[model samples]
Target: MGNSNDLRSKSLWMDIEVAPDARPLEGDQACDVIIAGSGIAGISTGYELALKGLAVMIVDRGRIAGGITARTTAHLAPLCDDLTSEMIKLRGEEISRAFYESQAAAVDRIEAVQKREAIDCDFRRLDGYLFQALNTDSKIIDDELDAVRKVGAPVHRLVGVPLAHCGNQHALRYPRQATFHPLKYLKGLAEIIEAKGGVFYSETIVREIEERKDGSVAAKTDSGVITAKAAVVATNSPIVDTLALHTKMAPYRTYAMAFAIKRGAIPDALYWDTLDPYHYVRLQPGEGAADTLIVGGADHKSGEADDADLRFEALEAWARNLIPAAKNVTHRWSGQVLDTIDYAGFIGRNPGSQNIYVHTGDSGQGMTHGVAGSLINSALILGDTAKWQEVYEPTRKTPSGIGNFVRENLTAVKNFAEYLAPGELKSLDDLKPGQGAVVRQGLSKIAAYRGKDGALHARSAACTHIGCHLHWNSFETCWDCPCHGSQFAVDGTALNAPAVSALADVKTGD
Candidate 1:
């Protein structure tokens, strides 16, 4: 795994330690259930199973809770982030209603868990506002109001939020939505799980997962193999499957920035606009003179764009336009979300495996999806039928989303075509210190990165997951695969899955 030196930016949550003393797996271990990732989903799953008295082991390639969960803005809204109207159009009213109920339950579960565990994670339930953007039709708000009502969620029609300008803007108010300090919550869960005998292995990479003939699953790592009655691959992108789930989802890079603002300058609530790529705003309570206002938006296909500085600038401008009292930028970071075709996650048993399960395709609702998916998966593992299983079944087909499926899968077709094109640079010499690029060397393309200290690291540009061409992400300082959401560090170590192995080193003189 890459270290702090490899990361170009950090999230506000990185200031806290989640599992500071956590160590990698040293030898063979056996548990009733093994989870491959330790973000909120994996940790939450372990908590659910551990509560049921099952021996659980959660492993991650990096520090515990250091993955995308730490990068999240921590919006716990149960309503669909992508608009419930669009979701109902694709998944139908029945499945969409079930989806809404399950998501609400997840939020309730989090509330109950924090109170019962006494986790003091700054968890709070507040009203959420969905307002119309400037120059946009108010019909969207009406559609959403009707759709949310059809899904059985409480909503109130409104006109205007506590922001600058537009006192008469059409909006809908959703009561009892939530926000939290994600890392703190996960840290509490990690401690509680550990106290309950759940094991955590940080900096441990699971290379492969195989289902045995005797109905047990084995997770093979470099150090040893872990055998379990069942396994869950909750890595943001499922590392176990190459095609099944990957084809149904696409990766998107979303940006978030926090700014300092005087307390009481803005109400403590979740505010979102009705835009294609919507902007979200919330406040994080501070102990000092000013609280932190987090605003997130500016989403594009991962690996397709390298304009993060511009995106951050746009976000800052948008924030200031709405809240003139917004002060200096405190933190800016980006995270990847796996958007499924139908705007819901795929959480269930792996398509072809008996005991192997997966939880992925967060679709921008990761905070709630993580908890909701855990409930569904844990129930199935305990031999009970999950109420919303059909809504999120990994193997289920979405005939309604065929158009979206085709449109998203085209990203792969276009990416593969890049292989035949010239590299971003003609040679490695063109790369400068603290910079990286894809350089052409004869017929092969090399991912070349020069450290701030002027050390050259080179690797194959092809993604280990499916040989898709790699794109350099200037913001995160990593190579991203547009095909399957694999991310590699400057040294070619796979940072995110569905690619477990590092990028192959380019041979000398190639």
Candidate 2:
């Protein structure tokens, strides 16, 4: 496990390379809608509205599909990371059915795009299995199957699955689930959107999104502004309306790896177990070209721990146990998932704003949720009635999730007490090159990182999101906030949202 490949820092999907460099926003611009992300959610929304003849502009801080989108396993299952049983308990049967149908339709929406644009992203329809892990009780699976029946989703029980790993466990199977090359599909969608007169600006950072007089919104960027009739904060987390959303959702880090396997080695199906942090498995075609057996699991609270090496080790062990034909791990990466207090995602207008909209809290189901955002938000923007609108309304509260919310928020409150706790290192002398530690100076705490070139860089230990002290993540080489997962690079640049401004720099001598 210690000999794991260092390529784990990047996603396996990056192997399917792309090079599209759109110019950044140079001056003031205006459009029918200003979308502040370039991932599936933003692009899907832009494409849908462009079909309706609306002028749309999408801006990303980096390249397209370079963020969390590239890091996905690319499973397009109606099955959510949250169990159907839990969904029924939280949202009731009707809303849960709507959630399931919405995701199923999202898969159909992807298929439609592939057909309409002639995308050859290896799209395939397959069955999905939810089985009991060796340690989990069988009654849990039975309960879930019953819940699926109650929700009217088409699911069946399977006694003998093809995988030799789970020899005899009864698995619940959902047919017509799917998989695809996410980047390739995005490339096709980007081309179609452009052909339809939609504009995209990569490497353009949106600093702020605020409303103006006469019922319009303005997204401020480094070069200029984008004034539009409406705005969509399709970033993984909304950069605007920081407090309301961040408090309701918490960030989680999940690890994934792709191992080479012979073509036809495993069935082309999605597999999941019933563990607390259960593993998910899927197979992709790459026989002579080096096929992939993608598996992901081992989730933990972001910034709360620095255990990537151990997490990857656990996943590799699980893969070997279940996938006998698995070879040396070719690609490994970790992705950030925002766990909403509620099971469903939020895809509607931001609370307290008229023209600004947001789509986030995918709840570990980014692919379906992203498309659902496009379906729901675009309808809201177009003033059309969307069927699943209330189910995913941004303002909807979950009384059932209140217990989990309290527990998570209490953890956040405890992290704020780090201001009084002793620093991670007693002094800078204990720090190594390319390592970082929080140190106390007088009464203030400092985040100090020593570069590989022997230069020391320091910044305020307080996270700009909410003043929670940042912790050093050796695996990612960033200062991560335990409170809301705001990450900063070694030199104090904000790497992710909910926190737009960089950390205040500190002068570090010696």
TM-score of each candidate structure, all chains considered together: 0.98, 0.96
Compose the digit string of candidate 2's lDDT tens values, residues 1-510.
Answer: 111122126887775533375678899999999999888899889989998999999998767666788889989988657899988888789898888889999999999989878998889999999988875678988999999998788899977566665878778999899999898888888887888878889767798999988899999987999999999999898888757888888888898999988877778899998898889999877757568899999999888888889999999999898888899898878888989886788899999889899999998999999998899999999999987998888888888989878877886888878889998899987889988899987788999988777878889999887788888888777787877777787777776777777789876666
Instruction: For residues 326-366, write the lDDT of model 1, one tens digit per residue.
Output: 99988989999999999899999999999999999999999
Q: Judging by TM-score against the true structure, name the best candidate.
A: 1
Give residue 280's lDDT in candidate 1 (0 to 100): 94
lDDT of each: 0.91, 0.85
- In model 1, pairs of residues that clash are none
Candidates' RMSD to native: 1.2, 3.0
Task: For model 2, state the Cα shift of residue 466 in Å.
Answer: 2.0
